[model samples]
Target: MNIGFIGLGIMGSGMANNLLKSGFNMYVFNRTREKAKELEDNGAKFCSTPKELAEKSDLIFMMLTDVRACRAVSEDKDGFLESLSKGKVVVNFSTVHPNYSLELREMVKEKEAMFLESPVLGSKIPAQKGELVILSAGDKEAFEICTDAFEKISKKAMYLGDVPKASYVKVVNNEAFATSLTAYLEGLAFAKKIGLDPEMVFNILNSGALSNPYFEFKVKKVLNDDFETHFSFENMKKDLGYALSVADEFKCYCPTLAAVNEIFKKGLNKHAKEDMSAVYKIFDE
Candidate 1:
């Protein structure tokens, strides 16, 4: 497939590189043209605009930061929709509001193109390894046609029915992740306050039933205070906001998530560009 990928940030760059390595004919674009240089060196074609990329590609994938970027890329003067035609598929891997995904679906449909909400789970490391799990929804035919490309970029890709379902699930997953990480950081802070060694506490936790790969992987970063941006605090905060929106839409009471959301909001002042694990610094403060 001739694949067009937009937004070559930390995650998108890794995924796009893997596709290029897999020998796909890749056409790429990024707001900052410099980000696409490495991929271009690796034989991927660099397009100056989304419309140009869409015009030459069969499947266009967007791994943008948020809904606004997605909108601008699709509706701008030289947007993808300008050149999108029938039989083309546009897959969005950005974590966006499910409602917005539905709206984009309609817009793409109007262009006689297919839109898939296929937000992925995993950050820079997994994306680089092509091990991220994909949560996808839209037309099954579009999903099927992209299966080979998906395999090149993900460990697994699930088709979850229709537009917005996959987006909804991605927000819920991030909600659980943010809340759980916050709870873990709070407990570590409590341990330190009580004169217990936080590292020792983590060792105990890692030995127990509560242990999982995320905690194991993150504990080292937390202890060493390595707050690199594998996934940014701002993005996690955005996902939490999306989660709260979903909660409000369904009339669901998510008290813990609401509290966690506020904690992330507080971190926005200082740690927004850092890793999500930097939420620990809020407690450290």
Candidate 2:
């Protein structure tokens, strides 16, 4: 299948590589023209705009940052909506508002195209290894047709039955991750301040119920002070903002998430100039 991919950031670039390696023909675009050139060098075709890329491909995968960027690629002049042909499919892998995904679904149908909300659960490393878990919602036929591509780019694909639900699932997952990571960082910092060896604390943590991939992977980065951006503070801030919006819409109280949201905000403030891992620094203070 010929696929068009937009947003060639770290995660998007890794996904595009996996698609090409999976033997699918790829047409690419990114706001930064140089990003497209980098993919072109890897044997992918480049398009000057979303419309141009959409016109030449059967499927379009968008891995942008937020709802605004998603809209920019979906509805702007010469965007995906203008160039999508009947029966074409557009899968959004960005984490954004479920309501926005629903709106995009309707827009795609108006164009006689299918829209799939496919927000993912893993970050850079999982994407690089094609181990990311895909949370998808759309027409069954569209899901079936894209199964092979999903398999090539992810370790698993979940069919969530509609647009907004997938977005909800993504936000819930992220809220949990952000909250747990914050708690872990705070406890670790407290232990260190009380004269416990940070390394020994982590060793005991691994031996207890606290051990998991997220902690194992991130604790190392925290200790090493490596705040390189795989995911950014900017993106997490957007996700937290959307999660709280969902809470308000549903009249739900999520005190833990609200607290973590503030910590994430503080982390972003302290390291507004650094990476998402800078979130750990808030506790260190």
Best by lDDT: 1
Q: Which pairs clash (backbone N, Cα, C closer than 3 Å) in model 1?
A: none
lDDT per model, in order?
0.93, 0.87
Q: In candidate 2, where is summed lDDT lowest over 10 consecutive residues?
A: 268-277
Quote each prediction's TM-score.
0.99, 0.97
Model 1, span 1-285: residue lDDT tens: 799999999999999999999999999999999999999998999999999999999999999999999999999999999999999999999999999999999999998988899999999999999999999999899999999999999999999998889988898899998898889988998899899999999999988986989877886799998988999999999999999999999999999999999999988979999999999988888
RMSD of 2: 1.2
In terms of TM-score, the best-performing candidate is: 1
Candidate 2, residues 148-190, lDDT tens digits: the string is: 9999889999998977889999999888887888788888889
- Model 2: CA > 4 A from native: none
| Alpha-carbon shift of residue 155 in model 2 (angstroms) | 0.7
Model 1 weakest lDDT span, ten residues long: 210-219
